[model samples]
Target: MEFDVKGKVKEYYGGIARKVNNGSGKSCCSGTSCCNEVSKTSLIYNGESLTYLPKEALEASLGCANPVVFAKLKEGETVLDLGSGGGINVLMAAKHVGTTGKVYGLDMTDEMLNLANSNKAKMGVTNVDFLKGYIEDIPLKDELVDVIMSNCVINLSEDKERALSEAYRVLKEGGRLAIADIITLKEVSTELRAEANMWCGCLGGTLTIAEYKSILENVGFKDIEIEVAHIYTKSIIENTYLKDKDLDDVANKLNLDEVDGAFAGAYIKARK
Candidate 1:
């Protein structure tokens, strides 16, 4: 059967919103052992950064890295977070931009939007607004935002080129792009790429570093820089995606040992 990529994505993330609302305090993406391990060690956020935000925001954070930390947002600057799930990055950006600046969190899922808005209200954060929209076609005016931030969400897009183009379209001249996302160092197998679970797990849709940088450059972004934040080891994948599966079958298809340097959590920085 063919996979409904878009429908699966919504179903996967919408469930995450519901779980957070139920006080689960568990990240949907980190439900597996491999993901849990990565979350504890790979993702970075200062204690002070999490202190002022609603607890729900921290619980719902599914980012591979903290884009807000790399964004270096200034007070009074307008920032937009594409695919801002549960509003963690958006809230962080709001604090950085202050009362004078506005932060917009654009997400496609209604559940996430509701959860984000609830968090916003709880925190009394007037500077941030969560909107419903797709990353490929952002629901904002062109050249309006000072910076565009995203967290591990872009790789999920089926049309990455269009998404990056939209990101460029919404940014002001000289505006910055700070994103934390997954990238692949080597090509994955066709079988793995076809796995819906892997795609939703932030693995299947990843582009190689060269492809990622090229896409940004093609979208008219300059000063592009990609920093490797964390590399996923074979054991991590085995624990998460390959657990209880036929290890030799996968190894034969994808060469597990050769995939040592394959996957990474990348911090991507660029300018429009």
Candidate 2:
């Protein structure tokens, strides 16, 4: 039987949103959960930049890296954030675009959308809008956005090609794709691929940077580049992600060597 990759990812993120709503006072942990970015707001954002944003918005930012930094957003340009969580990036981008431009945050999970809307309200940014939708099938019309950005969310998509295609479709001619996400350096084992927990943790669906470039190119993107932020070494994987799981099963069958240097956080950029 095929694993329900989308189902697992949605459930995992939904749980995180519910936690924040319950006053857990914890940031959502998406990619590299607990290993790299959990509760480390300063690790992902600058202190001064976050001051005016909603406090809970900071708690709900579970992204692997900041994609807005890659966008080079211009005034009066519209932006769409795929899988926008907690509305932090949206709010920030709203400031970048000012009152003349708009930023749309698309999320499939209702809990996340609610939390994001709540954050939007707290921030009092009228230019920001949160929509309910999947990343693979964006809710916007074609050639409508000036920039497309996502933070650690596309890796969770069950259908990456379709997602990329939709991203291409929504982008105006020459629109940019500036995103921060997890990428693999090498192929993963079938055993590891079936690990539901790891998938929800943002490891299973990633493709190598080359694969990403190829897919983006095939989808009619140009000038593609991927900047590596950090590589997961052997010790980090073993000590962080590989702990507290059933070792007797197929997951144990994976060679630690195959896992090491296999994943990294990257800034993926391209033109549509």
Candidate 3:
């Protein structure tokens, strides 16, 4: 049997975008469950800067960490957000960049793209543009972006190396990479790696912190730094996905406990 990793990811995220558009469902793939609304709000976006945007935009967000917070966009700087689900980060970055700066939101799913555009219309944000494309192959011109940001998105790519390479290509001479993604703290087992559900839920396809650094270095990025923001505990893992025997499998493999951090939400920063 063949497992369609990319198809599963697209289907899962496309479903999320549609659900958000229809004002139903919640984010379940960001390590923290969006169905747990209170925790989702506090854990992801805690600032008041995004209050002016459409409520649905915030509700549609499926990010792990606030990359825009870590991005620290300056006015008049061009920014690009890969996999800009619902345009939360893109809109937020637009605010930080002011009117002079331009922000591009790239997503492969048409459903997500439509939802993002709908949110853009609701907010009347002129500086943001939602593009349709894959992270592995960005649609923008080369050496065009001053800052590149993504939130919990890069890890979903089946070919992470290509995705990172594309990220590096779009960045300007002194561009920065401020992204939030899931990084594994432990080695993944063969069984877990083959689990499509885990992959769709932000677990199966991931890299170690060291692997990220090495890839960035090879991609000609400098000043690389990665910090663990939130560790996905046994309870969190259980609550996030698979409420059945799958939980038992993950527990047995990771040997979950309070002290054992199997995976973490990390803030990765680098300069091109």
lDDT by residue for model 2 over 11-106, one digit each (tens)? 877877887788764543345754222335656765236778777777777777778777889999999999997787898899999999999999
lDDT (0-100) at residue 167 of candidate 3? 90
**If the candidates were sorted by their TM-score against the true structure, best first, what order would they fall in?**
3, 2, 1
TM-score of each: 0.87, 0.88, 0.88
* Error at 164, model 3, angstroms: 1.0
Q: Candidate 3: how many backbone clashes?
A: 0
- For model 1, the stretches where C-alpha displacement exceeds 4 angstroms are 25-43, 240-259
Kindly list the per-residue Cα lDDT of model 3 for residues 159-190, writing each as its tens digit: 88889999999999889999999999987566
List runs of model 2 lying over 4 Å from the truth.
27-39, 238-257
TM-score of 2: 0.88
Tell me the lDDT of candidate 1: 0.82
Which is the better candidate, 1 or 3, if ranked by lDDT? 1
Clashes of 1: 0
Return the candidate ranking by lDDT, descending: 1, 3, 2
Position 101, candidate 2: lDDT: 96
